[model samples]
Target: MKNIFKLSILGLGLALTLASCSPEDPIGSKVTYYPLITVNGDDFMSVEEGGTFNDPGAVATIGDEEVPVTTTYEGRFRGQTYNSTLGTSVADLYTASYAATNEDGFDGVATRTIYVGNTGDLVTSIEGLYRSTVTRNGALTAQYTDMEYVLIWKNSDGTYEISDAFGGYYDLGRAYGVGYITPGGVIVANDIPTNNFSFPGTQYNSGFGAPSEITAMTVDPATNSIDLTVVWTTTTTYTFQIHLDQVQL
Candidate 1:
């Protein structure tokens, strides 16, 4: 009976080991590897407004073997849609995406961003009311929150206008005058969003200087947020950054 029990335990262990074993692949079977996609040119391209654009496509590969890549593009240019056409008129933002599929039904994808505009113009669309966050010297400055409120939109004359040029930091008087009065604003700001011919900010008034100048402005592509920096006689040393988040378009 003791010998029989030992033999039974050994047989169970062997059975478990056999069940856990993986079957070997047939001879000459190929191993599957996912494709790696690499874009050909610059990930971001700056094409002039109303200029001709030719897309330099991307490439995909599995190990050293090259695979066929399928490419598609979508752009924002005066509400125009073109997936294969090369003409780009007016200021626009385009995303060209490349995709490849392997035999095992695995897909690899990559994209390129194209900004179409003339030099020194707003690249992407920013015409709308914005939820603004003003930061001075890396610290949140909420005092001028009211005056810092900004609105930007297009005009019939094909120009742009901003509510406040300073973006924020003045107009310490939302209620009554305490520190300073609201500074006057800019009338003719920049180009239109369609032609990259204009500016930012469509409403409100803030800042100490009578005319707050927008020294620099840019949009962060990743967050789809616009950042504006303003400087004036009162705040000449450093400028406050107003991060504009779109509230209404």
Candidate 2:
């Protein structure tokens, strides 16, 4: 009986010892890992007008394992018709959005800007003389009448001269400016020097300045006509729609 009692005590002690040495439950202390997603390839791309855009695709990963990801794309472009007058092609700007999502609910998004331009020189394509008309609609609409007969001279060196001949005659002494066309088919006008000039009968000088801006320009090669939008600001902003026909110099 004593031997059996000792065996029972030994077994109980062994059980308690095993219980103490065993690992604790780690449910609350476990760390959860999440998958990461990334887009692959250039964030900016360019294509010719009506050209095909090939997607380079993307990848996702969790630790050393590559996870499968789904991708989607969205695109936007200005719907301008091709110009036939000048035999020049109209350039268009397009933006594409790429998105990737992993099974772990993690996602990534990337954007690319595409410029569809003609194969011609950007500088030579925009050089010419243009006639502009101004219209006002916001805040100070009725305070001014439509101004006509504005002139723009786009020179070969990417420099331009503007004459705000409000009543069919040049006034403000022609403000000199510089500008460039982007690969994405956008025209950016840089700041022109501020000029102080007096009207024909005025004794005091009035200050005239040009605003830096990005405007839309379309070329029609067939008609030799270029359509452009110019935004000018002084005390208030004025938008001018210009139709430039290459004056047979």
Candidate 3:
């Protein structure tokens, strides 16, 4: 096993802090991560500032190009003894081919290349069917997996929603809304036209607290990772850097 240690997208300072000795969070010892997006060669896309894009790599450039980086060893699951490997390939959400490797000593990797244009040539990779492979001893088995609920940003309402009802749940007059609650027990979705709401009286189904703001959303040009940053209020904030490849199924 390689002593791989890198920083989480949370912050460079946080990464460094974790790299040294961290007791606040036991998971801090991990440094390497599976990139949510990655790039190779001419395939690329342009993302709006604050929008989310997914890919892999250490750094993302402005042109949607990702700098390729490698892990010393495969990543392990939360509590599993297995190590999983990810890669860039042609099989992807939009189009590309790649696969993740597991126990069989086979290289598990996947990749997809996209094109970017100034005006009409802009393109992005999307997700496709879920594919899985299992190998025991020397035998390999394949399985088709169903997708889980995907969280989406609603442009019209300027809120977010996570759904699992196969698209029919939100088709009617019901949709989940997110917000922040004030220390005084008031909940509101900033800039949204609805009144302060709660689980029963709210327009949407989800509420955090008040003063939460969308911090940063962008695509790294180097790794094509979709990074998100949000400030729940004056005192609390959250950031996420994710690669699209991790969303398989």
lDDT values of the candidates?
0.57, 0.40, 0.27
**Candidate order, lDDT descending:** 1, 2, 3
Q: How close is candidate 2 to the true structure, as a TM-score?
A: 0.33
By TM-score rank, best first, the candidates go 1, 2, 3
> For residues 1-249, what per-residue lDDT tens digits would candidate 3 score against the true structure?
133333334467787887788556555453333333334443433333233334442332223333333322221111111112333221111223334332333343444432111111101321222111212122322221112212222222333321211111222112331121111111223422222222112122124333433333333334322333323332433222212212221
- Candidate 2 residue 90 C-alpha distance from true site, Å: 11
TM-score, candidate number 3: 0.20
Cα lDDT of model 2 overall? 0.40
Over 4 Å off in model 3, which ranges? 1-150, 153-207, 220-224, 234-249
Query: What lDDT score is found at residue 222 in candidate 1?
Result: 49
| Model 3 lDDT at residue 215 | 33
- TM-scores, each model vs. reference: 0.42, 0.33, 0.20
lDDT digits (tens) for residues 1-249 of candidate 2: 999999999999999999999998776554434555565677655455445656565565666677665543322222342211111132333444444455555565555554443332222443333333323232223212222222343334454333332211113112221111111122323422111111111111123443423245555655655455555455776654545454332
Report the C-alpha displacement of residue 106, candidate 2, in angstroms: 2.7
